[model samples]
Target: MLTNVAVLALDGGHAFELGVFCEIFGMDRSDDGLPPYDFALVSATGTLVSTRHGFRVEATHGLDRLEAADLIGVPASDPDVPQPPQLYEALRAAVARGARVLSICSGAFVLGEAGLLDGRRCTTHWRYAAELARRYPRTRVEPDHLYVDEDPVITGAGTAAGIDTCLHLVRKLQGSAVANDIARRMVTSPHRQGSQTQYVRRPDPGRRSGSLTPVLAWLDAHLHQPLTVDQMSRRAHMSPRTFARRFQQEVGTTPLQWLTGQRILLAQQYLENSEEPVTAIAVRTGFGSAETLRHHFFRRLGTTPHAYRRAFRADPAPPGR
Candidate 1:
C-alpha cells in the first residue's frame, strides 16, 4: 500500500541521506519484479536546495506533492537551524491522514520541531540523541538502537542505518521476499533488526601492538566451540582482568555480549539460506540447544528462530513466479 514516496529536500541537507531514499524508493525495479514507487523530491523552502556537500539539487515538486505521498522521507540537516512553519504543518497533516514519516540521522530534529515526536519513542544518530531528548522532553530517546519504529514516525540512527530503517518499512508493508530481493540488488544485508545496537567498535589501526583483531578472528572461526573469558584472555596474552578491561575500552561492549551478537548473526544466516532444523542450528551457532537458541533469538531479535526463518528465508520459486 506504500506505493507513493516523497523525500524532502531541505536547504543544507546532507546528500547521502537524501540519496538513501532515492536509491531505495526511486529506482525502477519493476523489471526485476520488485514493486515500483512513484517517487519525487519535494522542496519545502524553494525549488532549488543547496546541500551541505556544496552541491545543488532542483526539487521539481513542492510541499503540495506531500499530499499524495504514502511515505515522506526527511534526510539529515542542521538540527539547530529552523525549518519553515509550513513544512511542519504539511508533515503533521500528512501523518494525520495515515501516511508515515521517516527521519534519517539529524532529521529527527525536524520531526521534533513539527511536534510529531511528542509522546512517542524515537531515535537519531548517537551524537544527536541527547539533544533530541532534551528538546522534546515527552519523547523517550533510545541512543543505542539502530532505529526506533513508533508507527507513523520512525527514526533511524546515523547514516547507514537509514538503509535499515527504509528496508524495515518495506518488509513490513510489502513482504520479506520483496525486501530481500531489493537488498540483494543493493548488495547489502537483508535485515538488521531495529533493536540491534548502532555502536560497532573497531580497534584503531595505529594501536596495532594492543589490537584484539587476532583474538576476534580466532573467536569468529571457533564460534561453534565453547569459549570462556579465561580462554580468550590467554589467546590475547593477557590476564583475564586485563583482557576484559582492554576489550571494554576498544570494543564498546563486553566480550560475552560481542560473542553472543556474532553467534546470533551466524544463526540468522543459516536460517535464511538453509532448511536446517533449529536444534542443528543451535549447536552449529554455539547455542548448545534449541531452547538456548530460542532464548537468545527472542531476547535479541524479539522473534523466535522459526518466525525469523519464515520471514527472511528466500522463496524457492524462480523470479516472476
Candidate 2:
C-alpha cells in the first residue's frame, strides 16, 4: 500500500542521511520482486535548499508531493531553526490522510514541532534523546537501538541508522526477500534489530585500563557461561567498587545492562538465523532459560522472541532449520 514515498528536505539538511533514504528507497529493484517506491525529495519550496555541510539540493517538488505519497520521510536537520507554518500544515494533512511517516535523527525535532510525535513512541540519536524528551513531553523517546517502527510512524537514530530504518520499512511494505536483495546490492545489513545497543561503551575508565581488555574480550567470547560482575572485576584485576564506576563511565551503561544486552543480541540471532528452541537458544545465548530470554527480549524489542521471529522470518526459524 505504501508504494509512493516523499522525502522532505529542509534547510540544514543532513546530506548523508538524506542520501541514505534515496539509495535505499529511490533505486529500482523490480527484478528482485521488491515493490518500487515512487520516492522523491520534496522541499519547503520548489527551490534549492542548503545542507548543514554547505551542499545544496535542488528540489522540483514542494510540500505538494505529500499529496500523492503513501509514505513520507523526514531526514535530520538543525532543530533550533524550525520549518515554516505551511510545511507543518502540509505534513499534518498528509498524516491525517493516513500516510505513514518516518524521521531520521534530528529530523525527529521537525516531526515533534509539527505535533506529529504527540503521544507517539519514537526515538532519535541517543545524543539528542534527552533534549527531544525535554521539548516533547507527550512523546515517549527511546534513545537506544537503531530505530523504532511503530507501524504508521517510524523513527531512527543518527547517521547510517537511517538506512537501516528505511530498509526496515522496505521489509515491512515489501518482505524479507525483497529487502534482503536490496540490502545485498547496496552492501548493507538487511535487518539489524532495533534493540541492539548503540555501540560499545565509550569513555569508561575501567575498560581502558590495560588489564580489562582481555577480560572483556574473553567475556564476549564465552557469553554462554554464567558471567558475574565480581568475576569480571577479578578478571580485570580491579576492585569491584572501582570497576563499577569505570564500566559505567566507559560504556555509558552499567555492567549488568551491557551483559544483558549482549545476551539478548545472541538470543535474537538464534531466533532469526537458526532453528533452535527458545530454551536451547536462551542457554546458548547465556540467558539461562527461555523465560529469562523472553523477559529481556520483550523489555528490549517490545515483543517476545517467538513473535518477532514469526513476524519477520522468511524461513520458519524455529528449532531445526
Best by TM-score: 2
lDDT, candidates in the order shown: 0.89, 0.81
| Cα distance off (Å), candidate 1, residue 308 | 20
Q: How close is candidate 1 to the true structure, as a TM-score?
A: 0.65
Candidate 2 lDDT score relative to the true structure: 0.81
- Expressed as tens digits, the lDDT of each residue in 162-247 for candidate 1 is 99999999999999999999899999987864353414333333444448978887888899999999999999999999999999
Model 1 root-mean-square deviation: 8.2
C-alpha TM-scores of all predictions: 0.65, 0.65
Sequence-dependent TM-score of model 2 = 0.65
Off by over 4 Å in 1: 193-321
